[model samples]
Target: MLKMFISGSIANNTIPDEVIKSVDVSMDKNYVILVGDAKGVDKNIQDLLKINNYSNVNIYHIGNKPRNLADKNWKQFKVIIDESNPKLFKDGKFTRSAQMIKDKRMVSEADFGLVIWQDVSTNRFGNVQVSKGSLNNIYNLLKMGKPVGLYFVPKPDEGIIKLTDLTYFENGVISNMVNVKTKQYYYEMKSEYEKVETQKKHDKKSQGEQLKFF
Candidate 1:
């Protein structure tokens, strides 16, 4: 079964028709989804599942209470604060570390990520542009050798979703098993499969240098 983590832009609440159809297909295939209790795409995802009566869903929340308590029947996992980062209280105000902790946990266990994103950032980080919080999970999945299906939210309220990588969904990636990891690795890679190749070359070069030193 495909286990997907759904995330999206916090700025947009719109849902495209293509996204709805993809969720339909995922539900039909008995996919289990993990979503946060935040607004934006998370809320949209909850709407889709609840309206369709898809019971195989889990909602992740931060702190003692969830930000959105729309689905009471949905099982929720409260994220424990990470002591290393230490974001419990700042100036008597709650920080967003709780959500980040939950996001990390979600990325660690998810088989694949289905996200709605729009590249609104003009500043480029090397080859890639800065992305939304949803892309954080997507990048983590890719770094861990997991696949992701991205639906880019269009401008001007066009009700369509487009995949950044056409060959991603075509490949049989959802059938793979998910690895259990305690931490998530968020790094810049070449591309989906290109990153694998790049990593292989880097490892080989490192091994060669080590042999010469020995």
Candidate 2:
């Protein structure tokens, strides 16, 4: 059975109908859904799974127990963190590093990923900023040679649209047409984006040298 890793931004408390429809399609296909236990998209997805009475689901977490599980009967894949890593623990609580460990495991186990993204702000570079965790999940899956389908929630009132559905890209590089192909997994986008950024830096350095010689 195909294993699908699904994650989204914590900022988006509600899942758009379009995204839900896609999940339903996955369910119809009997794909094993792999999800996290956090609130927002994770919890929403879990609730959907429970409503459908779907049992082929695995909840990934970083502790003896998950923070939240919509269906208690669903299997839990506990990610044990090393006690020796100080960064893994903070103030008697598991840190983001610990959560990332769980995320990485999900990326490794799944054949592909689905990300629900909402732009939080725009950076100084005119690039749209989104939840790091969601982006990390996408990047990790892409790096692992697994494609990811991205759905963008432009506004709370407006439902999600496939990233390709948008008229313009968000990041100017990673989210562009060439990097993330239409209706396909994000194949080699990370490496390609990096190459473009590197070239930009090289061009700037060469221009600086030319100015010095003048």
TM-scores for all predictions:
0.65, 0.71
Give residue 2's lDDT in candidate 2 (0 to 100).
99
Residue 144's lDDT within candidate 1 is 76
- CA lDDT scores, all candidates in order: 0.66, 0.75
**How does candidate 2 score on lDDT?**
0.75
Instruction: Quickly count the clashes in candidate 2.
Output: 0
Model 1 alpha-carbon drift over 4 Å, by segment: 83-88, 92-94, 121-131, 154-214
- Tell me, by lDDT, which candidate is best: 2
Cα distance off (Å), candidate 1, residue 13: 0.7
lDDT of 2 by residue, 1-214 (tens): 9999999987678877777888899999999999999988999889988999999999999878888898889888888898677899877888877888899999999998888875354557986554667766867776567877777665434344333321223353245422222223333444565798899999999999999987
Predicted candidate 2: what Cα RMSD to the true structure? 10.3
Worst 10 residues of 2 by lDDT: 177-186
lDDT of 2 at 51: 92
